[model samples]
Target: MGDGDRRLTVNGSLRSVPANPPRSLLDVLRYDLGLTGTKYGCGEGRCGACTVLLDGVPVNACQIPVDEVGDRSITTVEGLASRGELNAVQQAFAELGAFQCGFCTPGMIVRATALLRDDPSPSETEIRAALNGNLCRCCGYPRIVRAVERASEIGRSGGGRP
Candidate 1:
């Protein structure tokens, strides 16, 4: 289907957005839908700042087209929380002070959320690997890693995945 004809579920809601077929999912999410939580760090997808979950797997929103996302469930950083409660990864980032300047935190948290969902008991190495696509200029990698680890623990302990 054409970009303007594409429809998908975003953050648990259905949205029919307009795009240019080549337009990135990042643009549709941010400009078309106003889900600005997903940042645009590296347009090349080298940075995870534009990360979002496509069917619960972390993918660079900057690399995917709106037409390619038809009928799939897309979860942006804005969807991570609900009803005024933060998700586990968000809480972990806050408790562990995982961000500086906070530009990359949203993508990091979204990626971490996927990691925890796939493996609620990932080791430090696994966490690092999962977050390899994301880059933080603030040099907050250490704390971000710890936050993922903590979020994993929280999930394992039946904390409702935050």
Candidate 2:
């Protein structure tokens, strides 16, 4: 609770990273905590490759300073699994081929997870709007949208894992 002592929960675990210079949450997650699934792209936060959940909402980790993390719970891509099994969204992404290079997969999955958590049955337009922030260079936009639709169905069948 003193200066430079900041604590936050990530992937269901608590982390106490330093806040002296206030490193980006992305750096804390990847460098300090060894969670590399959250990728680094367009450090400006426009690419959404460093997306993660902050208190159940999707955010660009690169845009958030570690000191600002405070006590919020951050969910990385690694936290998507439940009991060692892939969650509905993850499975949908895999089965539906939502990604090609896979570099942006983690962020896409995390953002989609948040979207599904908020609305399990989002329409195509809703899915597109939700994913507007995330970009994939492989041009797999259609597949990505299909994957979201599949995840929605799976979630409706009680297959989603927070």
Candidate 3:
């Protein structure tokens, strides 16, 4: 709570970090707090690999400074799950084999999670548009889009308990 320290609510927990020597939220999450699920891709905000939820909205963590995060809950890929079970999007991704390299899976999952929250049943075009920012070098776009559709199905069926 002091000027020399910065506090953040991450994954439903309150954490403190040094305020001086400002760094991006990605660095704070990966290095400072040891929450490595949020990846670092293209330090600029172009790549969605560093996507995280800033108070329920998806954003590129690499573009956000830790000092500016003050009090907003940060939900990383690690935070998408509740209890010990995977969320609907995560379950669909795993069940449908949506990822190849898996490096971009975290961001894809996080972004898809937000998309599903807003639209429980997004069309193929909608899903593709939603995930357009997130890149998958393995060319897994088809599977990824299907996984989002599958997630919508799972959510509507109440099978995944999302």
Candidate 4:
């Protein structure tokens, strides 16, 4: 096997690509696997538009090296839905109009999913803290917060599942 040939498992699919060793996970995900749901708002890690779950933890895809991902399970917005059913957070976002431009919706939903998984009932402050890394330029944070809260309530009441 050549040095450039690397194996990456993304969104439950395994793929082999001729990627440079230093290539970021964002590049591999977008260019190689065609998972464009993860956006590239800022090359740096400040913006969470490029966020994806590496082993269920939100991380900046632009800052993660493909080679370093190894056997970790990567989950992007594409994986949030299953069999034509949207996840709870996604449905909440859609119902509440949590996003304006939709550029940051994927990352926000991903982070909110993680938050809900960790805390079934999170206070507004806890939700804000959980989503601190993700930024929305459209200034839709209030609705986003409301969406997360609603999702939590729906989840607890067993109404979040599709």
Candidate 5:
């Protein structure tokens, strides 16, 4: 590897790429690695559109550099599903029509995934706090909250195979 190059694991695969001085992990994932589920909403990390799981914690991809990722496991929205089946949170989101524009769905889903893993039965307030960063212009908070609640139930019921 070159001096400015780093290798990182993303979505169960190891990939090595140049560590661009100014480019963020969002650029690396979308441009270098072809993973575009993590969107670019504000580019300032406030919108949560670029959210991704780095070592199971949610972080804004646009605020992180490729070299900084190191060996941590990165989970994007693309990694949420297994065997072409949507995860519990995703299924709940769809079933509840939690998204209208769908621009914030990926980040919301990613953040919710971590939330459920930490607290399978989070209260609505807890769910709101977890998804505070992700913004949906369509004003879908009520349904989104319901979706997360549903996902928690699904998790306990062994349904949706999430």
Candidate 6:
């Protein structure tokens, strides 16, 4: 690593953080690395729209400093797919039309991905509780919950994996 350059693992690939890196991981992921799938909603940790997997845990990228990231692995929404196929959660969301405006879909999917990875069969209440921090203005919570349930089924069937 150079004076102002940092290195980290992103989407299973080793990458170099931009020189004079931006303050927040969100900015670096979007502007510096062109990983724009992580949305910028509230610019605060309150909104989970900037959620991403940092070391396999969902975090509000807007609140994580670039320096604090160090060499941790970061996975954006774009990283959920494999072999040109969407992951279980993403496919379930798409098949069920869980999103309305689509602005919060990426964050929701990223968070859901982590949830399913940790617990493949989360109950409806557990799903809601897990997604409490991620707000959807279009009132798509019903579809979102159903999609997660469907994703659990898919995951169990080995049709899709998170």
- The local distance difference test score of each candidate is 0.87, 0.89, 0.91, 0.89, 0.90, 0.90
Candidate 1: global Cα-lDDT? Answer: 0.87
Please say which candidate is ahead in TM-score: 1 or 4.
Answer: 4
- 1 versus 6: better lDDT goes to: 6
CA RMSD of all predictions: 2.2, 1.7, 1.2, 1.8, 1.6, 1.3
Judging by TM-score against the true structure, name the best candidate. 3
Candidate 2 residues 1-162, lDDT tens each? 567677788878777777667689999899988999999999998999999999999999999988777788899999989788999989999888788899889999999999988888899999999999999988899999999899889888887663
Off by over 4 Å in 1: 1-5, 19-21
Tens-digit per-residue lDDT, 7-124, candidate 5 = 8899898888886666799999999888988898999988998899999999999999776787899999999899899999999999898898899999999999999999988999
Cα shift from native, residue 155, model 5 (Å): 0.4
Clashing pairs in 3: none
TM-score of each: 0.93, 0.94, 0.96, 0.94, 0.93, 0.95
Residue pairs that clash (backbone atoms under 3 angstroms), model 4: none
Tell me which residue pairs clash in candidate 1: 88-162
lDDT of 4 by residue, 39-59 (tens): 999989998999999999999
Tens digits of per-residue lDDT, candidate 6, 36-68, equal 999999997887999999999999999998889
TM-score of 4: 0.94
Residue pairs with backbone overlap in model 5: none
